[model samples]
Target: MIDKNRVFRVLQLAGLVGLLAACGPSFAAESDAAGDEIEVVPVRGGVYMLVGGGVNATLQIGDDGVLLVDTMQEDMAEHLLAAVRKLSDKPIRYVLNTSGNPDQVGGNPVIAAAGSTINAGNVAGAIADSTVGAAVVAHENVLTRMSVQDPPPPFEGWPTSTYFFTPTKDVFFNGEAIQLIYQPDAVTNGDSFVYFRRSDVISAGSIFDFTRYPFIDVDNGGTFAGTLESLNNLIDLTVPEDKQEGGTMVIPARGRLCDESEVVEYRDMLTIIGNYIREMIDEGRSLEQVLEARPTLAYDPRYGADSGSWTTDMFVETVYREFTANGSSEQ
Candidate 1:
């Protein structure tokens, strides 16, 4: 049976514990006002999610070294480095980012400072194109979109490695097989999720976060349907229902080891909001009207309110834009 009480307690304590204890004694420094707790925690196996008020990072420990999915903030790198050191003496070999947010890839220079190369997906392609010394790794799309931004300065770290067009990219690191699936226009353009094939665990980056509502960076290719499709694809790869709890683990960008049911709850919540927005849009409701409709009012008791930077209004806005955009596209 799922221990409901334990889950709530963890959420409560999450504001206090930070991400170090769960991973031996790695010192991951968290910023003040980042809340009392660092948002990091160990769900199952050697996979750990660095929590708090930033992007999600996944750590895979191997006899050779460690493979990190994402590292948040340049300031927090030392803490992340310390935390990893506590868990094992393994050096960080690969850093994979799911999207193009600074909070997700800001730690790149820090890793470089520590003598470890940070590998980002499409997001890092911009930096890789400009700099000669940086070891940026990513797909072609990431490379192509690097300089659409402004005075067109050279990329900081161009992709030293690239993958062809495919929904999923596979890699063998730290004695584990990791499958990275790029879901176009989800949380952000070129958003990706990491699946630990052998561990049956999914590090959902920001795609499956419980802390706040979704933020669709439209300029960067985020869409409502894309996020849903991405979630469905992930669900298909998880363990079956009967083996939850002790079975496969689903680690979000924040929070505890989520089960299939919790995932369903989140999915259903999104669906409900999507449907509500669709109905409103079909009725010729404007975006402002949809926001005022407060379709998620009933859910406020649970996923309502703000947990740090994420708020109810933000969730409503994200859903409204996505549904409206989707509605427009179908026509």
Candidate 2:
């Protein structure tokens, strides 16, 4: 008595609907304005989130000088610098890069040049090099990748300080302990999460994007599993004030500031999608069948994109390829 044919047709139509939704115009990209206006939002403890210029940059200002994280793009350096000047007249002591993406480090040359580095007094009682500028710190992999680009970044933009083979690098500035935790193969192999201990804030680079689906640059050694691991690491570093409501604040690569709870939700979403795709792969489904299955259907309404630099289809494919390439759906 069951209408088997009707049920099959209904399922097929549902898959088509999911596909259509995934391919809809990219609302995620349009919503984020990478324009001239840079909004300076204060987080706790002399820390601020500079929003605009395609990505967010974090600044910790005090009497000692400023420690800035991420420098937006090259063109927006002036706007970003103007915003910094408004907050503090002190020199920028350090520029911490989360990744090597152009949007994340493009303004390095200009921004770093605008500040002076702290140097010990020489025998002559003068500074060693007055124009040394602020120290740009990042994972050595960032310098390696950026240096080999078609048109390499400006010499001034290259990181002056790099860490590798170590899980984290730490420095004390502006009365706070800042730690740069290396997150391999997340957004890129060189991604870092900068934690301001005194401020109780973390500047999570591309590892966490509150707006759109995480962009895993497979060509650049980024892996879906690694991204999930980094998100887990983020959760580990955070502590909630009460009932998981507030405590440690997070400034994502883009979008609004968040706390522990929001991060858990994002992590859960990725985990669920990963499980769905992995199950389909274990069923011996081909890539085409997998796409048609719409593993990301539930999250499409929130993080899906049809036509952006990254899309839902792209994410699904990345996960699928990552799993199948291993010849086993282990992860």
Candidate 3:
């Protein structure tokens, strides 16, 4: 009495539904007044954070003008502009991106067209520089990919400036030193962290996000080991126990301020999940078998949510891809 055809058809329909959900458009709707809304949070003395426009934007109030970090969506640009104006009359001096992901750099085009704020680091220049002249920065491998074909135009804001050199760069503003350091190839190819010495705050960008699954952009040189290494570097450099202010503050691309230890824990959780999948791969398990293993079960309560926007499966897939691609070794 088992209806095999009917059962198979039902399973097929379920599969199609899951696929559609995963591939659906990812951007959420901007606020009706997002164009005019700019929310500011005081990070410390002279530095305030303006975190609307769909992505978190940090504002460091310099003597002459304010420095901005990250812009949200293109549609939310004007709203972000409105938000910044509420903070100070000084011209916007610098707009830095912690990474190259669109959510972090997408609003660059509109924000740059509005005026001459130095979009610092990787994607910043991409947004400000002319289309033909923009540069891409990363390891030589990224350059190779760029040479074959530019990243999708929409994705390539085209960084006007590129530095494939040092792991760290420091700039002085208003008697404060802001340091930009490249991590060991985590999150994506050109992931960098912005450390504001004066505010005693660090914007680790996507490297510290808590809401969604960790996004390892393998195509852009991200790796499982690299992600953990990057987090370790941040903790060592900025979150020394004596220096931590009760809680070390971090501005995630799209969430509330997180503390230093939270980041460490996140990294450890990722490492565990990544290791579990790697073990499965080494045993010659298929991707399906790895999924069935459900290695993320232990950490699900901490990071798992119902949001299909960025789900647990996506995290598992990213780590497994990296594990297999890199020969399933320690990294």
- Cα-based TM-score, every candidate: 0.74, 0.88, 0.74
Q: Candidate 3 on 53-73: residue-level lDDT in tens? A: 545777777564556667766
The better candidate by lDDT, 1 or 3, is 3
Candidate 1 at 59: error in angstroms? Answer: 0.9
Q: Which has the greatest TM-score?
A: 2
lDDT of each: 0.61, 0.84, 0.63
In model 3, the runs with Cα more than 4 Å from the true position are: 1-37, 117-158, 240-247, 305-309
Give the distance in Å from residue 246's predicted Cα in candidate 3 to where it truly belongs: 2.5
Rank all candidate structures by their lDDT, best first, as comma-separated numbers: 2, 3, 1
Worst 10 residues of 3 by lDDT: 129-138
Candidate 1, residues 116-146: lDDT per residue as tens digits?
4434532343212222233434445555555
Best by lDDT: 2
Candidate 2 vs 3: which has more lDDT: 2
Candidate 1 deviant stretches above 4 angstroms = 1-40, 52-55, 115-159, 241-246, 305-311, 325-331
User: Which is the winner by TM-score between candidate 1 and candidate 2?
Assistant: 2
